[model samples]
Target: MLSGCVLAGWLVSGLPALAAFKLCNQSYDVLNIAIAQPGPEQAAADDFVTRGWWRVAPNQCATLVREPLKTRFLYVFATDVFGKEALSGAIPLCVGTRRFVIERQGDCLLRGFLDARFLEVDTTDQSDWTVFVSPRPS
Candidate 1:
């Protein structure tokens, strides 16, 4: 089952904001996050690009993707500093022990990576999006 992490999205108001994908850590502990999306050559290879290991402090936000959002769906997986699963979902994705940029999914162990289940976040075609990771309820 997925943790009680909350995910919310909204457009930045006021001045024009740069298009990007961001995650906010509202939990009491630091979080390690990873994200996956359709790769640039997805249409040709039907693959996904996953990257991760962003250490986000409590109450802080991190920009996972610094460019314009291209896809409507993004997969995310997060764990606390203790290495306990904090947020996850039904979709399986490949992740690494440290900072990594994996080009494809499946056969993670064979490829020298770990397999993780990531929560799917639908951006609804927004240009910029931020996912708020709230603390799991007591």
Candidate 2:
């Protein structure tokens, strides 16, 4: 079960304004980015932007909107914080007008393979992601 597919590495190469940006699963896999954050919406309200790059179907794969968190997920090497981005982009946090408070828990990394069998997911597999969340500036 853990040795069938290779967890595709997603490279978010797009406009940086998309703070809460989501990447397309290159290998057409759907996995939960179990965000170890606060509660809900804080991440989106602060630095979350959605990036739509699903090449299969509009309803295929998972997007930020579908993420357990209400923001976009970016892939990093280890630990890297997102700084102030000064670009003009409109990556809506919600599809309509449901403003969600992004969840911010660990100001470090999000480790743990989401259970696929128990959770109905897009990338229904065991994939681990590293979320580099930095401290909010005072």
Candidate 3:
């Protein structure tokens, strides 16, 4: 379980905002994060492509999607070094024990992957967004 972790999102400020999806870790320990987005053929396949295992250290940030935002929503899941869930949500997605890029969701166990709940982030169609992960209030 997450021992007091909070995830928040916002846009970065600059002459021209960086067009990318980023996550900043303010938690107390290292974290492994995953991201899920609509598949290239989402309209026809109605599926999502999930990628993961970005090792983020405390007080640092990682650029998950290094391009202009194309989707209004993105899903995220993260865990601490000990495999304890640090951030999650209602969206169930598929993940793997090692680095992976799962092409679809559901039947995780049968598909040789693990089922994980991901927090859905609404970017409000912003071109650039940053998610800050920090310790929850005591």
Off by over 4 Å in 2: 1-16, 29-36, 40-138
Candidate 3 backbone collisions, by pair: 4-136
- Please, what are the lDDT tens digits per residue for candidate 3 over residues 1-138? 245355556654567767899999987789999999998888744389999999999899999999998999998999999999998998888999999999967789998999999898999998888888887666
Ranking by lDDT: 3, 1, 2
Model 1: per-residue Cα lDDT over 11-107, one tens digit each: 6589989999999988888889999999877774428888989999988999999998889999899988888888888888899999999997778
Each candidate structure's TM-score, on Cα atoms with residue i matched to residue i, is 0.91, 0.21, 0.90
> Which whole-number lDDT from 0 to 100 does residue 115 have in model 2?
14
Give lDDT tens digits, candidate 2, residues 8-68.
3333555533223233323222322322222345444334322222222212333343333
Cα deviation of 78, candidate 1, in Å: 0.5
lDDT of each: 0.86, 0.25, 0.86
What TM-score, to 2 decimals, does candidate 1 have? 0.91
Worst lDDT run of 10 residues, candidate 1, spans 1-10
Count of clashes, each model: 0, 19, 1
Clashing pairs in 1: none
Off by over 4 Å in 1: 44-46
